[model samples]
Target: MRTIYDIEYLQEVTTEIQDWDYGLVQGMGVFSTSERYAHIELKVYTRDHYTDQIIWNVKEEYIPADLSDFRDEIEEVLTFFGNYLYALKGRREKKLVYEVIDGSFCPDTCMRSFVRATARALVNCFNKERFKPSPADLNRIRNSQANGLELLKSFLTHASQEEVVASLKNVSLTVDFKALFTENELFLINENLYNSIEILKKKEISQEAYFKKHKLITKYGDISQIGMAHLVLILNRKDLLPQVGVFQDEEIAYKFLSC
Candidate 1:
């Protein structure tokens, strides 16, 4: 069975299909014109060699009108990250299939889709500020990630497509639409969420509903801060557990509920 979902404003997103894996995520209010460029949360699952591990992962994709070519460099940025994860896991090359499990309590809808290195990059970027380097200066602060986010942020700030493409030199990235768009029908969703304060700082919002929905602050480099954790404070609504996301600490839970 299949059903179509709709975003409140954009209706062309009305075309969608429900299969074994994805449920009804057609086109909800992900890309916000106001506060959030995009924001979404959903429980997910990943299967290991033996048992399955459920995870709460999100995709943070932000593009400003400044740089029209930001979309093209997505693949290179993600590829670097994909290489990074495999290296961390002691694997060398890119593998065609990666294991993922259902993160929700409900049964697997069997959404026929695979994850991407870029999606992982989105996770990294959504983690926090200072997560991605800001300056092109080689003597960047020590103990930092200097992969490709600095250039991404710069492109978003300047909108200089040529300059942004040029900045990719450091990471060996190029702005070509070929790598960014794929043939597959399934699209990756979800990314780490930002706070209200951070989202307000950027000069790009055009909608009011996004601000009302408690959307997190987001930027282009969001994909840069994936693996790192920020000194973030979570609020436990006591009733809003599922919406808040995964956390394995009493203090985090306590601090969340206290404030």
Candidate 2:
């Protein structure tokens, strides 16, 4: 059976977009049709090795002249429908395929550039929102002093779908090293000390040789803002230092740690 998803008013479209692919399913499609009005089609199909059955085929059509204007509304509607379809996913009883196809006289030119881009953006948003952190991971994000929650929020909202999926999959790994140090111990290790020690370790230099090679900027115990900021930066890198907290921006990290 076929249906109409939803209709909306004109809004502008942006040019920059990435393709949408989730698991084994492709989320975007553009097709050639008779030169009349541009059409966007969304479909859900249940398939097995031998049989393919249509669950629902929903479509929305727009005038070519109006496509540019209604682009924003188009995005909203697409996202909404995408979410609806996402809710239907993960039914072990059936294997489903979800698709957004655009029909245009020049599918390559019209749908490929605009409607397809919108679909991709919607998919990206979904990929970002779909991730659910474990309870322990949530505690880490909460305890993070570097603004870890904000970094996670920004990553989900702004990053590409692939980036969101791949980078966040092992987000817990960023803090795995924390087990080796107490929170106080980690906080005390300033960037200067860390960097110097790292160089010495990498070069297999003795502590005496390392001290002789590099000039001391300040006494090791001095709590300089640069030293503190660097400490937070390293700890908050990718929010990897789970105990240190994560910041959405470096400037924020410097400000939060300096004070």
Candidate 1, residues 121-228: lDDT per residue as tens digits?
234233323112234211221211232344345323321222222232322121121122232211211122333224334334453333222212125322112101
Off by over 4 Å in 2: 1-44, 48-95, 99-259
Model 2, 1-259: lDDT tens per residue?
2222211111111111112233343233222234312223344444563432222232222223223433443445554544444444432344444444432222223333444334433443334332223364334323332343332222222222232223333434223323334555565554333443333233322233322222111222222222222333446552322222234454653444344
Q: Which candidate is the best by TM-score?
A: 2
Q: What is candidate 2's TM-score against the reference? A: 0.20
